[model samples]
Target: MKQTVEPVLQDKFERRFLYLRLSITDVCNFKCNYCLPDGYRPNGTKNSSFLQLDEIQRVVSAFAHCGTNKVRITGGEPSLRKDFTEIIASVAQTQGIEKVATTTNGYRMAEHVAQWRDAGLTHINVSVDSLDANQFNAITGQDRFKQVMSGIDRAFEVGFKQVKVNTVLMKDLNDYSLPQFLDWIKHRPIQLRFIELMQTGEMDDLFARHHVSGVSIRNRLIAQGWLLKSRQANDGPAQVYYHPDYLGEIGLIMPYEKGFCTSCNRLRVSAMGKLHLCLFGEGGLDLRHLLTNDDDQPALIEFIQQQLETKKVSHFLDQGNSGATPHLASIGG
Candidate 1:
């Protein structure tokens, strides 16, 4: 990929867009309540729906040209992609790109952990809601807790230094399991994040039943003697903190409690090639046609820049709506 020092992608809010969350496939292996509560069916087989390797590389190049240094490869479950390691290598090697990461459920990761680490995968964020086998099954609608834990261990063993655990702390569901989560991270250099539940799908009742506030989590951590302080790094929407007692720090992502709209700097590209400015946005600019039908790089940059002007100040989901325009399953969380 040829490198060009394009101007940094800045939105009207003066938020510099240096991070890109690129979804390679929307289809997943497990169904979580926060996402596809009912199970998922791929719109097309691997032969047709998923973005081709070349297509993915071009998107990375384009975003890198627009000053996106960090790229997080997300999916319904990213490891489900057959050439996942290759995708990591491609993005990690792109000119001007600094870091490449993946967010996965960890079911299919054990087999390829070493390969991915060797292929330049910078970080891994595993979505684990519970440590109990039964609760895990109930949450994900899958019997893969052992597999997931094994994959997480493998990632750490393979020397992926920044392996973090993303635990969605629900109220009645997994709220009682915070101790279990803390015990699991003991003496391990794995940071844990309690992601507050957000209204993103057709499940208002679910949120009412299981949504846990970040304040509750903070109090729990303080009771455990964790010295928590607000972090300033705008790496993402995570409200980070530090605890000297633990090997790794703790974080709280309050998408509903604390909105990060003023400093929202990330843009999303769905697997089908649509550029989304907000996670809860309804529509996006189609870049597939530009990639396949045209060869004008400047035109592609201009198109994305123009669309960035229309980004919503904050997500519509935050407003007490039943759901957002695009369901969670369609985009990578």
Candidate 2:
């Protein structure tokens, strides 16, 4: 008998990806300016491209089989799906999938957090551009402040170990809201993160106009005598810090920060099931057909491994070159 060979999610550079971003749907309820604009529809056949329950199980289990232990369920808003609870539970139950996480706008999370937590959802990242109601609405193009806040509070109340708040800093837009953000996190258990907006899609112009460096924000935190903490083991990429007197920690994810690309361990799967090795690279391996069919699972596994060799040296955004922005709702950034 021939000895079996184990499969892995490794790139040419020898970095292994234990995490997988699984975007289940291209639908969303909120229209954040920096993300999904007021009127952006992700291109795809809603019925065909969007993974059905069985397809989701097959694809997730395949990746999990190849050493992907973590999965983050994302979307224009993952909560938009009628089968949100079922999806989470199913992904969580996949063999070899040790962790299941989700990123959302918190619009529908609060009321359903208990169900999510019960379904083995281990982590959550909520995008909160601003704490002020008016600014929040201005950024998201929706008046859903209370619902989001309620959801955040409910996550904590339900015993989530990690509840992060993501803030995308813009130059003239919500920069002034940082002080209030700090004040809010000073007493809450929720960790706050400052994300440097990446120039994707319609966000290129917005980034050029409103982008601010996360390094500057971290510097401000240090200036206030906050101490830098050693990196903790986690699937997501964010440099973390702490303040001795505060209840929450602070994190920064600057996509263009120096030395950011040398260690890459992420592979993105679009809502339509195309595998993108790099966030800004062109062309992708379409997994939709492979997913819909049942016979070539082993072949599909080998195809993914082969494609890993084609991972780019780095993202185009690092060179200050912005390409066509994929609608984030569709891509699940």
Candidate 3:
């Protein structure tokens, strides 16, 4: 039975979504101060398992049918899943999905990155908060900075033209070390991304104490002769900049900035199979039931389109509302 194809996913604000950030697990090994500080805790429930392979495949296929060209496999740490490579392959082989990316802590990258690339992983983003080893340890509660760095080198060796590094800029922390970050990326093909600290439901105190805007960073880049690059149709929200002297690039993700959501082009799906219209929006629509079989693809597509219509034009982050999001790890930040 041929299912009727729906129009591309778009919201009332006239923004078209061409990317999906799909979380494969809520379990993260790192205890980042802003996110899972104490470590990942299971609720000890029988139904706490993440979506299975088949479920992810069916849901991704439905999304592909609705015009999602890129699928970024995210997680508390997506690489933690044993079947992560399989997940990448499935998403890459899905019709209409041109890109298969993943975000990780780089714990296993040094060991398994080649296998990941061979399994159809198109792009990789690693979290590297600080250039100083000790500061990196303090921020992420891990002393594997050397290993993570090695993983990045391996990524390049394995033929990744450019790797992205996500650094959450926070006051009195790595915020002052932008110069060091710049020097490190000057000769490498790394896209050093600086993400603004966001306030979540569980970290009000942390947010108040460490939140730093990306405006200053953007200004600094412009003053330093970094040219703002135009965004592609399937690109994420990061405002990318390139310079003539550097082999690398820089990206700024300022969620609190005015008109930030005006160019939003991605949607999130939790590891437990809930579709989130916005990263900081309210509750998600449960789609796990609809992801069970291939026969459910049509209904799943319909439900997604219907729910997408209710998406808010912008998030309430400016109003201090990180609705239903306890922290970044829960839904794959």
Candidate 4:
């Protein structure tokens, strides 16, 4: 029951890598066409995989002891996990951990936001691709738009002040709804992030067919009288922009067009406990094995440092090239 500890500075970059996106489960409730293909199904034995909750705690604690300050729980949809609140509480109770967040599809958030907040959850990032119900269904293959909207409202009601709406803008799909989506958050203090679609999983054609850049989206917003002013104190992966007259902030994360590898300070631990240095990386260090081997904190910390040192500065995926990498979902976008 050790409290969260601050992350120790590593020599990979000048900044201390304090943030970790812990994917608790690879299993997702919704079959988003972009995330998973139409005919996709789990290939192996059901019980043969997935990291245990205790294993997660051990790994997270180890990272915290190494000076990690923030932990974000993500999944196919994290809320679908039965012990999600327990996991949140466990991560929050860690001594030096300053923030505990979760990114969910928001399908089941309405029934659990207050419970999560009570469990010491600091923030929530809900993914909503389209404001239109039918379009949403087409994108996610789930007719749960109303449920998600209700969840957003409930998240606000539960005192989660830093609620962010993550929208993956695909060309010709939900790109046109950007302004309307921004309009919905214009008066609220919510953060609306527009993510460029990356070629991953079964969406290679989709990425090729509708590759929309953040600049294009920003220009469109500008043409509509939405003035975007760059924020002075912004950090993290997203390029933040704000309207002087508007209430909320807009974040544009264009991984494809512009590379942020030099200033990138994030590390991703998959649902299975593999440490991925880059989102487009093909390999990772198996942290679950380290946890199960022994409570050897020093060994674990050394392994993490070794992986970080080997981390690539950035990733480049050329659509026209023959040997391009896989999509973002498989790599945990």
Candidate 5:
């Protein structure tokens, strides 16, 4: 059935996309300093219009047909949705989709992760910006550090091979805590990912104050005998590193790195069903109407391909242009 797809999804630069990051909802509960510093706010009356289960299925089917083997269900906090497990199951059961992953704030994860695993989820990524309880509270506006740690433990007890922990590196915040992060993952099978703070349209002052360079960290890792891991076709943009002595691994997501877009292999679909070519792209194309009918597969696929032609060679972050991304939560950064 997969062979029936007319053409593979590739842009003019010969970059073929095999990963799709689909946002199920834009609502988040945690108010992280780098992302939603103040907290989640409803964007008028558009919350009810998020893509439904059937719509998600059609979108995944179209991408799967176009050779997308990995689909990561994202959101401001995807687990905030009541039917989060159902969303995972639907995306997992789609034909040609080999991986079903999600990123969450780890709220009530100890209570819900087991059910998520039972629902056909293959990968879990939790955000824990700082290991210190007080620091974590200050960073995320929540005093749930112990809860998140327990959730990570529960994930392993439930038979997950590995769990990724995302730590958004911020100057004068968690930047000096890398040693603690390394030690925490030394004996555990956690892939600790250090993400550089990105500038968005609404976070100029915050970005200017807290932005840190991942290159310095990468250099430090290399000097300390960390070996780089080559990326798979359907993998995300993180530059993964490994060490023989440590049981866990390290990854850096540096969006400002040179040639970062050359390895771009994923596309994004907002919760409202608009296709976003780049995270920092100017705007999105409306795709919700086409997702309503099963018979619109051909048209939907054609529309995606046509839109791919207009994707830029690279983002304009270096030039201080964050485009339409008001915040990471809006499109599930």
Candidate 6:
């Protein structure tokens, strides 16, 4: 069942590069305050609307055929998918997929890290907003900090080489823990990423509450001797910085604070197989139809290419009022 391979040309004219963010499912175990707002209801349709395992494989195959070398599985929490291991194994086996990774909340990574690693998961990024148990509980709406931390420890113990801790800096909330979190990661192998809050979902209001820019955080860290240098040839949005004396690196993803849209080279596939050309896009291509109807590989490839041709050079968040784009959780951010 080897899928056909094709050459893909990135929008930036970069050759032999494709990074796909595949969302396996929209279901998540944790109700993070930033991801989900109060009084929010699960869009119940997602459970039934998720792409089948075979459909996911076909899509990955098509992407790989089109020269996709890297695939990162995400979800409401990717580990929640029952067939997650199989999915990872299938993607890892794809011809052009050089790397297979996932981003999870770390609730189940402890129990599943070894299994995922065996299934060919190369790296993982675990979301841990706060180090303190009480603060963690408040941020994630769960009292599972112990479980999450345990999962992180197990991931590193199980030989996951590039384990990163993604922390969203929410002002007056998790912002206070910035120095403490960076200090905590100094001795660990895990890289730390401080993400600036984006306007998505119910987070639009919280944007003003937690909108700590990456510049402020970096300047603060630099004042404390954290040397911020760039990493060459890294994929995705994060601007990575390394501390020469420290064991691991720190990344600052300032998508909102600093627009990196000119060099954006990645696309997103929602759990349902919608090809999102831009993170803030209002619409997506229905890739499920191409995968399910006669498995039209050529047509699918053309469709993606055409979409990319129309891909806006950059998004204009300033054009519309605050409520323009949908929430990030729904789009698998």
Best by lDDT: 5
lDDT of 6 by residue, 260-289 (tens): 675676788998789988777767779888
Across residues 209-233, which tens digit of lDDT does each residue of candidate 5 receive? 9898999999999999999999898
Q: Per-model C-alpha lDDT, please?
A: 0.80, 0.82, 0.90, 0.76, 0.92, 0.78
Per-residue lDDT for 1-333 in model 4, tens only?
Answer: 999664464645554577888887766767776677562355363623667777778878888887787888887667767898999999999877888988888988899899999999997888999999999999888899999999999988888776798998887888888668777887988889888777664566877888787778878767766654553311457777777767887888877665556667667887767888777776667877688743666787888887777765567554343122243334356
lDDT (tens digit, per residue) of candidate 3 on 69-157: 99999988988888888999899899899999999999999999999999889999999999899999999999999999999999999
Tens digit of per-residue lDDT, candidate 1, span 25-84: 888878898777888766555636667788888888888987888899998787777888
Error of 3 at 30 (Å): 0.4
Show where candidate 6 strays beyond 4 Å. 1-6, 12-17, 44-46, 228-234, 293-295, 318-325
lDDT sort, best first: 5, 3, 2, 1, 6, 4
Q: Which stretches of candidate 5 lie over 4 Å from their true place?
A: 1-5
The local distance difference test score of model 3 is 0.90
Error of 2 at 126 (Å): 1.0
The reply for model 4, stretches above 4 Å from the true place, is: 1-15, 222-235, 318-331
Model 2 C-alpha lDDT per residue in residues 1-333, reported as the tens digit of each score: 999877887887888887888887778888888877765574646546577888788788888888888889998788888888999999999888888999998988878999999998999999999988998999999999999999998998899966899888898999888888889988887788898888876666787899888888888989997787775333477877888889898888877887677666677787678887876777567887777666767877888999998886777786766554465665677
- Find the 10 residues in a row with the least total lDDT in model 3: 40-49
lDDT of 6 at 163: 84
After TM-score superposition, the amount by which residue 192's alpha carbon in candidate 5 deviates from its true location, in angstroms, is 0.6
Where does the lowest 10-residue lDDT sum fall in candidate 1? 321-330
Worst 10 residues of 2 by lDDT: 39-48
Per-model TM-score versus the true fold: 0.92, 0.94, 0.97, 0.89, 0.98, 0.92
Cα displacement (angstroms), candidate 1, residue 273, comes to 0.5
Clashing pairs in 2: 171-210, 201-325
